[model samples]
Target: MTDYGNIDVEQFFTGDPIEDWLDLKRREDISTGTVDSLVQKLQTNSDGTAFQQFLSNRDVGVLDATVMDLYDYRDFIREVNSKREMKNKLSEVSTFYNDMRRLKQTDSNPAAFVLSRTDTRVKLPNREYHTVEAMGDFLAFIPHPQMQTMCLCYLKYGLRRGAVVNIDLCCVNIDDPRYRPILMNAISNFIGRYAAVRIPYIFTETSAQMMWLMVRNVATETSATTMSYFRSTTR
Candidate 1:
């Protein structure tokens, strides 16, 4: 956060704190997809977003909001939505407050304190793992060669769909006696420094052959053509 003593309240305050904070987000270099999603959430939700509804109900300025106000919003989300949904809503509100605090718009972050109170454990559904026989069936089911190769990458290396599409041909060196055949380069954790994330392709010869064939095809394909096909097919 910026120096508390240096923060000029008169300069920062614009009579409407929520409008000013939202305008800050608009001018920020945040992802367009993220902004769109946040906007859609506020627009689509009948009760409005956690903070939006809170401000509407209380008719209080953003700077004047208290920790109790945040708890009230959290309770409101829990009543109308699942715990997981409440968690997400709280996170968004916390992020907004933290951003404002960092910019010297506010001294305290009420949502940050409320986050601990709203934490809940969400249960996940059981998943079935694919056996060798099941794998063969899955491979056979996918008729498209490139798509099958992509699936093989997922099955053998546990590569995410996004990572599979972004795998660079230059990083794949089959001749190198490395444990992993393919490397997902410069995968940023966002929380830490960038690092290379390797996905092992140490499966059967059939899978390796399919992967190598796809690699060869990718190597020969033009960038524009590959991107066009990737965009069209993925969508």
Candidate 2:
């Protein structure tokens, strides 16, 4: 009907969710951002079918799976699938694949059948030091102020990524007897080792006092020298 300029709709999508989900690869993590995005966009089974058709037409032998399964072993699955040689042999691959038609039939681990294809699960942590650019790209999804604080604590203090949320002033002190020495001890041991500090979130009255006292002591120390002889040393 009407003439329209050549436009690619693929350029329109921002891929924010996909990027967030993919970033987990650096941390040995997995997320259902892709499936969740699909589920949210695909309200009915027919929508899933449409996607299935698209995959099939593309000769992608992908199989349907739940969220949990995907998270548990996304890395291994990704590695195996990413083989460039396989592209020439196979159009697509499945983690729990079977080759019953072959003379030497084989089946994948049975546990794989029950695994979820959607969810967040991490079996390992990234061992190699993350480059600044890589970490920035991974953390860029989180922009909220408080969330940024939480992320910083993870990168700076080495706290577990998710555990940062439950903590408040009560449960954390740079010098609490239960926590301070341990963290300091860890830091002293790992001046450059970069160990993480994990503090259980257990708020209490003592923690409040301890933190306050530490702050007061710090203020007193810093000002003590500055305030001394302020009126007249020369006079």
Report the C-alpha lDDT of model 2 over 124-207, residue by residue, as the tens digit.
321234345644544453334674455444454342322232211222322334554554454345323322344223223333
Count clashing residue pairs in model 2. Answer: 12
For model 1, the superposed segments whose C-alpha errors exceed 4 Å read 1-116, 141-147, 154-235
Find the candidate with the highest lDDT and give its number. 1
Q: How do the residues 1-235 of candidate 1 rate in per-residue lDDT, one tens digit apiece?
A: 5765566686776677755665677889988787776777655655655586678778976778889888988887778778778789899888878777776757555556556567455433222333566567547744458856775765554323223333233333222334133421211121123123343223444544444333433433343356557669954
lDDT of 2: 0.42
- Best model per TM-score: 1
TM-score of each: 0.19, 0.16
Candidate 1 Cα lDDT to native: 0.54
Query: Candidate 2: minimum summed lDDT over ten consecutive residues — where?
Result: 161-170
